[model samples]
Target: MSRPERWIRLRGKPRGPRAFRRDLAETAPGLGAGDLTALLAADGDEILGWGLYHPSSQVAWRELRRGPEPPDEEWVRAAARAAAERRRRSPEIDERLCRVVHAEGDDLPALVVDRYGDLLAVELFSTAALPLARLALPELHEALGTRHHRLALDAAAARAEGEAAWVETSPGCPELVQVEEDGIRFEIDLRRGHKTGFFLDQRENRARLRRQVAAVEEAEVLDVCCYSGGFALAAAAAGAAAVTAVDLDEEALAMARRNANLNRSRSIRFVQADAFGYLRTLAANGRSFDFVVLDPPKFVPSRRERERGLARYHDLNKLALPLVRPGGLLLTCSCSGLLSALEFQERVRQAARRAGRTARLERLTGAGPDHPVRLDFPEGAYLKALWLRIT
Candidate 1:
């Protein structure tokens, strides 16, 4: 069936960075609340694009489809199927745990789907996508060959939209599921865990760490902010002599311990403490590691927090650099979309200088290919990792 073309007008010429939010001159009167609407220029009735109108949000409208053509159910289904096919074609992705859809990367805004074995976790970022997501679920199921799925809503977005945090579409779906990646097993609880149960974005990075650790016999490793022991277990399985995983969340530490036991990674030690304080104590005790990974949560969520967030990143790296022995490896990362890759690299350089160490950048990377970024949407490429060697 053809979708209805509900139209709304924009204030000025749409000549700027492509963003979810578009400035409005005026909206069509009597438009249904939160319905998908066609975006038109103020001068004429010509349809500019398609967007979701939410009067309550600061971004009154979120553009969904760009250009004249409006999107329909078939369009949404095709996008979802294409996203799934891309993952299937990528040899780097482990089918059991991979991102099935990366929202805007797939040209489907505000919708993300991650596959964990038979379970599919769907996250809706905008209210407009909620209806479209409902239409795409069956298509997603057919494309991914998974009937079991759950809607994992962002807590903040849920509150903003006046909806529940999470909802299960299928009955008898388990709270937790076991999945494997690169020969390592993990237990993921989609309902309670962060970002659809596991950090699938770091899958490749962890594999890289494993390979690097395997090259160094008896490598002592430290994983800061090690949620659920991804890097810790990877290093341990790679035959690291000792791996310490530190995080502030006790629950995460418990899960990390369980993951360690599940993988029989006895070399990892789980510690629940503030990463900064722990790093300070390690430095004071003159303790050092052959490899250190600093993967903190999003320090800069928005542009307003960039200045303070950069300072925090600088301070954290300053403390972390000293904990890496001479000739040792340091893998630091920032998930903040507001911090550019160049800015993050410069901060790390300053940190290295303050630590009185000369560092060589071995590699600069980001999330796995599963989390693909659209060239036009740089914000999608939020994860920045710098692999350095300190001397």
Candidate 2:
């Protein structure tokens, strides 16, 4: 992207550049970029940074780099190497599978890097991340020592640019690449799954759930929307007496079944059904569980859908809470970045009240250490999880 450097003045952002989509809703002074190319070359007078400049995107100019020194090929190489080295050394992160670069969290915005066995599945969340990816991927590949690189673009972000949603430039990933992350064995199809194939973000949470399951005797664990059986398999691995995993997607259930088989977990009963309907049926049949996990997909992707999404969460949790036996544990989660921790907890509190259950809030966790968040980018702190106990 050989484009002319544009100089712009930004104010009120003492922490860093405003890059998140949520920032767009604020009446805060907005900065517009020229339609020169996908990759942006710009100067904040003193700050020299490179970002993705999109005309139609929610955050049109999403800055990826910001520093006193101008970012270049060599600079990106060093940054990528450092980011990879950090993950490699983190005890919390599994070398077999982990997030090396968490966009802005790693001081590299717009770009995302995930490791899947011998290959690195690199995806640009938006075309805005492309400029940095172009400069960083080759260097990142060398740092990670991967056999191959699988490049993919975010379809939703691409569509905003009036481009095809699914765009891949590299070779397909190995089928069912097995990853033993955080002491749990998961066989995943990097080419077929969502967000670099597996939910590496839930690594530590799953491990925590496994330990919790182990502490209880004959724990009847219920995993809702058990995609590929991440949580269900974890519970089963911990020797839970009975584990019930449910999902609406047949393909996901099929994968979950395969994962159960791979883990040699025969205790889990896999069911393909609507999550709400299944929860309702479980409650109707008077079935209760020692531990229940509610990890649904993103409901509030943007500010416009905030209230509607919150209602969905409230309804889902209201139905699921009753199935949580008295004194049992419940883990509810929301991937919607727009829903703050306070907002999520309040919704759960409301749900518990509506369900006529006295729930004690035990913990509020988030994506594992692998998915780090920058202090300024509260939006980066997307995943909100609540650990509660029915009293």
| Model 2 pairs whose backbones collide | 52-128, 103-108
Query: What lDDT score is found at residue 29 in candidate 1?
Result: 72
Question: Model 2 Cα displacement at 202 (Å)?
Answer: 0.7
Stretches of candidate 1 above 4 Å error?
1-22, 30-33, 160-164
Q: Assess each prediction's global lDDT (C-alpha) against the native.
A: 0.83, 0.77
Model 1: lDDT to the true structure: 0.83
- Which candidate ranks first by lDDT, i.e. highest? 1
Q: Per-residue lDDT tens digits of candidate 2, residues 300-325?
A: 97778888999999999999999998
Candidate 2, residue 236: CA error in Å? 0.4
Error of 2 at 318 (Å): 0.5
RMSD for each of the candidates? 2.6, 4.2
